[model samples]
Target: MSVRALVVDPSAPAAVRLGEVPDPVPAPGQVVVEVSHASLNYGDLNDARSGRVPVGAVLGSDAAGVVVRAAADGTGPAVGTRVVALASGAFAERVAIDTGAIAEVPEGLDLAKAVALPVAGVAALRSLRAAGSGPGRTVLITGASGGVGRFAVQLAARAGAHVIASVGSTARGEGLAELGADEVLVGLEGLERPVDVVIDSVGGSQLVAAWHLLAPGGSVQSVGWTSGEPAVFPPYATVGPAKSLTSFVIEGGAGPDLAVLAGLAAEGALTVEIGWQGAWDRFTEAAEALRGRRVSGKAVLEVSREERRAPALLPQG
Candidate 1:
């Protein structure tokens, strides 16, 4: 049997389209989840065209769903459990995810919102920790209106850091103060103080400026490159004190971190801001909105309704 998925299509307008692929078959340590929702990331857009995901391959990394088949090894959640996972090829009707990468979604959190927690949430959590976020530290988050940026701002504040959010415009910087930003700047302008930690998503020239504004021994966790431009530094740019700009990527099993984020969201500590959400069939619209920066936080696509029952499977002797 085959299942529907958003596959990479180099010729399509968004380099992806709804298509059929073989139904997922779970491995001993993997469970088959019937996807309820999937979250889109800026990296997914580039993956479609940059050949990182390959033509005709399913393209997505974050999804929330119900496990239809438990792992044969009895490692993951039991069948019928709702979960969110950071798994590749997640934009499908069903996905086979390793137990280590899937987390049970707590009650009261919408699957659509839970779906937004994987890529963006984990990146924020990990990046902040890597940069040593805590009280008395000033954390600057670039691209503060985007998915990762919003999460970083809130997490940084919750960590007791003085959060400085930098956005492209004042309009995009709205509602950030309430989210725990001590200061929100339209650009890097009107800012005189050097920050101790910089979670920079907008690479290129903004990264260059952020480097200059880094306090001695400060750290810049390079998360995403939404700017799509080159970061040309002056001759003496990197000749300063002991500062670091470390590149970041979400690595390892994300289930534990995802659970933490879901728990926080359920308890009202973290807010999952979905800038756009709709049926998966409208993926093109969602992609365009995200690409044009019309979506502020996250873009989620509903893949299916909640299913309480898993399809009947053959019994083992």
Candidate 2:
């Protein structure tokens, strides 16, 4: 049997289209989940045409849903459990997710909001931990208006760090201070204080500016490059105090971190801000808004049960 999904279509406006693909058969350690909501990330847009995710393949990373078939190994959630997953090919009516990659959504947490936590939330949590975030440290999060940036700001503040949220414009800096940011700035201008840790998403010249402001022994976690611009360091730029720039990617079973985030959201400790939400059929509209930076936080698509009826064959891009 085939299933309806959003597949990569280079010809389409966002290089994706509503198409069909083969149904996923779960392995012994995998559970089949009927996806109810999926979150969109900036990287997903690049995946469509960057050859990272092949054309015509189902494209997505974050999904929240109910488990229709429990794992044969009895390792993860049982059938009928609501769960969120950070897995491949999640933009579908149903998905086969490995037990290690999923976390059960706590009571009172909406699946649509849980869907927003996997990619951006995990990155923020892990990156902060890796950067040694704690009380007395100063954490500066670049691209503070976007999903990852917003999450980082909250997580860092909760960790007792003095948080500085930097965005592209003053208009984009709204509500960051209320989210626990000690300071909010439009870009990195007029910032002379050294930062103990840096969670940088807006690469390019902004990264260069942030690098110069790093304190001794500070760590710069290069989480993302939404700017899509080059970072050209001047001569002797790297010859300053001992600071490190570490590239980052989510590379392990995310179940534990996802659980922490979901529990926080359930208790109202963590907020999930969804900027754009609509039916899965309107993926093009969502993608366009995300690419244009019109969406503030996360973009979520609601998958309907009626769309599970698959066509005879998958469409080619």
Candidate 3:
């Protein structure tokens, strides 16, 4: 079966193009999902422009789809269940995903909105958890306007921490305030009080500067390196005496926590800022928007509704 998908052709010098590709089939322990919606992240833009994976590689990591096939073993999703799945190559009409990688969409949640939660949501959850975010703790977040940063701010604040958000521009600063950040600072230099936890998504000199804002026995969770520079730690600094630094990388097995985030979205405790929306044909445009930092929230690529369904095959025991 031929299905429409975003194809990044190596031979074509132009940007990514939407074209028909062969539909994926379910393999053992895997199910073919009919994709409903997919969202863009920084990694997608990098992979599309750099051809890091392959020229024709499908470029999406977060998607909400319907399970069409289940492994015979029934270890994964059954047929006809709505789910939010995390995997690579989600830019296509159908994606064959491992059962373990998928999470059943929470009741009464918009699947399109759910697409924005997995990657950024899980990262925010893990980052806050690593930072020891909780009641009475003061959490500082850098790049509070970006996708991961925005989610971090909301999650940290919901955890009862006093959120101090830092954005590069005043426009973004305004939006961060609505996302529950207690205080919004335009730049790293605006931070006046030391925080118990810091979530640093903007690396480089910013990371170095944020390190100084950590309170004694405070923790900093480093997640992204968007600044194109390495983080530098000073010697015998205040960080040495009372600060702890850690890094968060979102891998598989975060489904349980992601489900919690999905539940929060259902309850309206979490808000997903939609920065840009485009059809599959405008994949390049969406990617460019992300690369230029023009988008404040997650960028989404709308796929065909026909792609949403449960697979026919079941996992074998």
Candidate 4:
């Protein structure tokens, strides 16, 4: 049962390695999925370079796969169903996932494209929920050129709010606009207007600066600390205006929200950009590209070309 996988070896000082490993088995309340596609995130970059993830740990978190085996408890998905699962160690040919963490992807959706929907999509939904962005409100999204930011821009706009996006460079301005952002601000120049809600994914000094532009009673959802700096909140200033500051971490049991995202994608209301694609053997290269910021949208690992059609794994009797 050898399966191709990307293994991060801390002992190796140069780069991550991709090869073969034993296929994983499903435990009770879990299902074993044969991965079709997996997406790389910023966390994967940190894990690869610093070896923060244990040696031999697979690096991907979001993936679309087929349920190969169901849990004995009959509580998980059924075998042969095309589904999306959120779990660590997804940079492999197969992964065992708990029932609560998997979602049945809608029909007619591209399995590879669905790989990009889970993490970034959920983050965008939660951020907008926290901000209370809706009709008549103005929402601002920083880092709109990146994966999560792109989803945030679309989700906020779909909710009938005017979206103002901030990009790191002018090269991404047009893409951000195409993703439904009402306005694209390149390099943070001339953005003095106030917004009802601000989704800050870049964090650091930029997050601190964004706080000033939020309207009184507005909320800011801080999801990622990609800037590698501690967020300093001036308590007196934030408290005076009754502003709410919150952070989002996607743990487990986010399937319901993911289902909503899948529905949106099915309805063509949400668009997923496939920034780059590579084979499982090329995962290290993809990781490097993500680390170097050479990829736009989301980069996916095409584990296999085979497609499965059946109900997702369900708990065994």
**What's the TM-score of each model vs. the native?**
0.96, 0.96, 0.89, 0.89
Model 2 TM-score on a 0 to 1 scale: 0.96
Clashes of 4: 12
| Candidate 4, poorest ten consecutive residues by summed lDDT | 306-315
Report the C-alpha lDDT of model 3 over 120-183, residue by residue, as the tens digit: 8888888888778988999988888888999999998888889999888888786787888999
Error of 2 at 126 (Å): 0.6
Q: Which lDDT values do the candidates have, in the order given?
A: 0.92, 0.91, 0.79, 0.80
Local accuracy of candidate 4 as per-residue lDDT tens digits, 1-317:
67677778765433467767787766778888878888888777777777677777777688888887877788866787788877888877778888888888889888888889877888888889877989999998988887888999999988999999988778866688788899999755798988899898889878987888888889888888777877686776566667777877876576788778887887788998887897866666777776666677888888744432343344444
Q: Which stretches of candidate 1 lie over 4 Å from their true place?
A: 304-317
RMSD, each candidate, Å? 1.8, 4.0, 2.9, 3.2
| Candidate 2 lDDT over residue span 1-317, tens digit each | 87789999899878999888999888889988888899999889889889899989999999998888888887898777899999999999889899999999999999999999999999999999999998999999999999999999999999999999999888888888989999999988889989999999989999999999999999999999999999999999999668999999999899999999999999999989999999988898999998887888899999864544332222211
After superposition, which runs of candidate 2 have C-alpha atoms over 4 Å from their true positions?
A: 305-317
Model 1 lDDT per residue over 1-317, tens place: 88889999988989999899998877789988888899999989999999999898999999898888888897989888899999999999888899999999999999989999999999999999999999999999999999999999999999999999999988899889999999999879988888999999999999999999999999999999999999999998899689999999999999999999999998999998999998888889999999898898999998844432444442321
Stretches off by above 4 angstroms in model 3 are 8-15, 19-22, 49-52, 232-239, 305-317
Per-prediction tally of clashes: 0, 0, 17, 12
